[model samples]
Target: MSMTLFCYLMMYCSGIVSLCLARKHIMLSLLSLEFIILSLFCIFSIIVTIMISESYMMLMFLTFSVCEGVVGLSILVMMIRSHGNDHLSSINLFLC
Candidate 1:
């Protein structure tokens, strides 16, 4: 594999590890998730470039990733406003 591909794969793996290990802050988890998405986007773009294919799919993926980021930030903001903090453990989903 190319060095660039290896780097991206390493980034993706690191993001997964961080996401799994981060059990305290919701923000940390979100950041890890974003990192994973970014790595995937980079890999996808590289593949598209190598294949000389149309970049519309990459553009669409980017648009969806941006939307996902906005939604995640809004959720984080809402959680902070309602709970006074963004701690993952503080969120009690069982509470009705």
Candidate 2:
């Protein structure tokens, strides 16, 4: 694999590991999820470039990722407003 591809894969793996291990805070998990999304975007871009295909799909993918980020941030804001912090353990579905 190329160096760039290897770097992206490593980034993806690290994001997964961080997401799994850093469960104390919602913000950490969100950041890890974003990292994973970015790595996926990079990999997808590389594939599309290699194939010399149209870039409309990449634009769509970017749009979806941005939407996902907005939703996640909104949720985080709501959580902080309600609970006063971003701790995952502090979130109780029964209380909601």
Candidate 3:
């Protein structure tokens, strides 16, 4: 279990790096964000289970994360429709 927690932590770190490096590609950045959120969910689940043994909060967090992902996807779709591309450079220029 400890090993699993360590792996999740590593994944979370890598996800952050990926998000930073893939800033130009909106889809890739969003995928990295998803990875980060999932790793966080795992870490929280393990900690909460060990400390409080209640999963209600975890479930609520999962629901919120799902809603967040949906909102992100919607925004991505709108960007694609308006810009016809998913690159940050294009978006920056469009916004300006």
Kindly list the per-residue Cα lDDT of model 2 for residues 33-93, writing each as its tens digit: 9999999999999999999679999999999999999999999999899889998878778
User: Among all windows of ten consecutive residues in candidate 1, which has the lowest summed lDDT?
Assistant: 87-96
Clashes of each: 0, 0, 0
TM-score of each: 0.93, 0.93, 0.92
Model 3 misplaced stretches (Cα beyond 4 Å): 92-96
lDDT of 3 at 5: 98
| Predicted candidate 1 versus true structure: per-residue lDDT over 1-96, tens digit per residue | 499999999999999999999969989999999999999999999999999679999999999999999999999999999999999778889995
RMSD of 1: 1.2
Off by over 4 Å in 1: none
Q: Which residue pairs show backbone clashes in model 1?
A: none
- List the RMSD of every prediction in angstroms: 1.2, 1.2, 1.4
Highest TM-score model number: 1
